[model samples]
Target: MDKRYVRAAVIALMLAGLTLHGGIASAQQKRDTIRIGFVTFLSGPAAGPFGVPARMAAEAVVEQLNAGKAPAPYDTKGFGGTPIELVVIDEAGGTTKQVSEFRNLVSRQNVDYVIGYISSGDCLAIAPVAEEMKKVTVLFDCGTPRVFEEASYKYVFRTRPHATMDAVAAALYLLEQKSGVKSYGGINQNYAWGQDSWHDFDLAMKTLKPDARVTTSQMPKFGSGQYGAEISALIQSGSEVIHSSLWGGDLEAFMMQSVPRGLFRKSQLVLVAGEPYLHRLGANMPDGTIVGARGTHGVFAPDSNLNTWLKTIYKAKAGHDPNYPAYVATLAFLGLKTAFEKAKLEQASSLKPSDDALIATFEGLSFDSPSGRATMSLGKGHQAVMGTAYGTTKLVNGKVTVTNVKHYPAERVTPPNGISSPDWIKGGMKPGK
Candidate 1:
């Protein structure tokens, strides 16, 4: 052969070698580990009381996934494969800090999916950003109704029940369970979580008991001490039942202060998100007080095999009873995994599986959570339609425990569409004089 022909042959062989190596690299990339951004209030007053439990749950779920433990019934992997590794971030600061950290996580760290957010304000702040960035954000604990009120984002999803759901459940339980309880009062923090919860609860009470009266409504600054004035006002209001959305340190302080002032003993007291306070308050909590987790309680100890297993694992890991926040993180991971697997199964030639596709799969998706079954709405708002647990607090084995747990379906409590919460409350349901 001529020299030119020999040179061409050598070049072709080198090109062929490059193509083979490239194929191997592409295969490796396909099997690359997935990265999930786990963000939450990891420091400050919220950490030990509420945020730390969430973080631990996230860590525990991730550990189980890596170990190939059976994912919850809602798991998308059909009970196989390791889940994506979580990239944790401390959202200890306020909303501004959360937005900055979220941007960094997505733009710089390049996380595949995001989970965690205990504060409703932080959730609302991050929702739009998550939409703009086109990342799948599973809000683990942000329950404020405003987060999904008017948003048209397809990527934002909440794995836990919304604030309205909690309020409605509380209202219904009061009406059905506590007959002859005529008047209602509220004491909530002034922020989004508190305001929304109070308004929603009011609406629910009005719907159930048209003559139910709201004697007093108070909003204290978030994390403020000295509830002396609020407690004095509540005592004077002559309300038979008082519902409060206070949590974290605020809750601890309120209970410590109010108990001594005889606020709870005066009448029926309902403490929303009360599970976190049980361990903190211990036997000091007032018995016969109505309290339950905001959306779900890990202490219910449902007879399901999954629940038993989770309780055992959680107890072994955390050395205490797991609260609702832990389940929030676990549910988030379950939601993402389900969505991703569904997207993969439904892959088409033109529409390959991507983050957007995974998000779309969340609609109408039902999964068995630590709390019973949870389903997502298909409309603009991707809120989880899950069950709520209700019960009165009791001292068991020298510990505060919420007993006589009754599961309430979400549909029965949530306000009907097109009605504002305030209007719903004011229309009727005045306490009988």
Candidate 2:
């Protein structure tokens, strides 16, 4: 009787072990595709110049990733061997609409991650929503410092530098090039992005060039192409250097109007964000115009394998050279790829990344980008910083090119930990200090 009972028990135990092993194997085999939501200005004032090229680059990169043809570190198949699916969303709608769209991407679309935003107001409005929704999000282009300064969020990050870096770099370029120019004039768009950029540039001017004075300032409405009145005032005020942070269609419109009106002939123009429009404006864009590309992006980027690969592919697909937006979009997507791979390694799982895992992996992470190495700060805040590039625009053989290009290290352009950008400038922080 004892022998028979032992045999029966052994058989039951063997069957239980087999069932458990099969369950675990099945769970491991069932891998879901990684879904991502990409939002950008696909159909608005920013569409033609900024968002369209960004979307084109996004599509090409996703395709390359899916094909397992991307560069090293991101060279593996789509998001750590799991195929990636992308959903594109337009960011033309105002702030309220963007908030709704971001929620929809998380709740309805069930996106594992979301990226892209060009409008600073949209970035500010959506950051809190992303936090409340507990969705992993990235802002590719918005530059307002308020995203992290005004409030903090665990689930959101910006893979590009803020507006302050752009302004600071612009001011440094101006002073380095034309130190004798003592008068500065501002003509930023009337919006969060424009206002913040103007403030930062003004502060930088005062900090670096204490003797310089702002002769006149204009807060033109965003998308308001009519700048005749503002141009008139700028000319009348006798400004030696006119600092502007306008971008996309607005930047293009200003360049077009000002060129015809001889505004460029009167004063030295410093455009904080002027790369994207260079392709469209070509020779019309005045030579020697000081321009900043937010970071070491686009035309100002140094030669590297990653930059060359992205530019080649993007140009082939879009039929034009990639711009600043494309570079930032690629950076954000590559950062996500890096984060997903890291999560997979930490969890020892081959499945798609979860929202929490993605966020944890991204915080304080560093990776290579077209612009150089980008670092997400964990000690200060979850903000990504990279080197900045600034230069003057020149027409070379019927093509727009940047001259006197300089790259400012992230430490120089980015503020120190626990200090807001404005305070950092007013406190007399200088590059390389």
The residue pairs that clash in candidate 1, if any, are 210-429, 211-430, 212-429, 212-430, 212-431, 213-430, 213-431
lDDT tens readout by residue for model 1, 279-324: 7788668888888787765765356756666676678799976788
The regions of model 2 sitting more than 4 angstroms off are 1-31, 378-381, 430-433
Top of the candidates by lDDT:
2
lDDT values for all models = 0.75, 0.84
Displacement of the residue 407 alpha carbon in candidate 2, Å:
1.3
lDDT at position 303, candidate 1: 63
Model 1 whole-model lDDT (C-alpha atoms): 0.75
- Residue 422 CA error for candidate 1 (Å)? 5.1
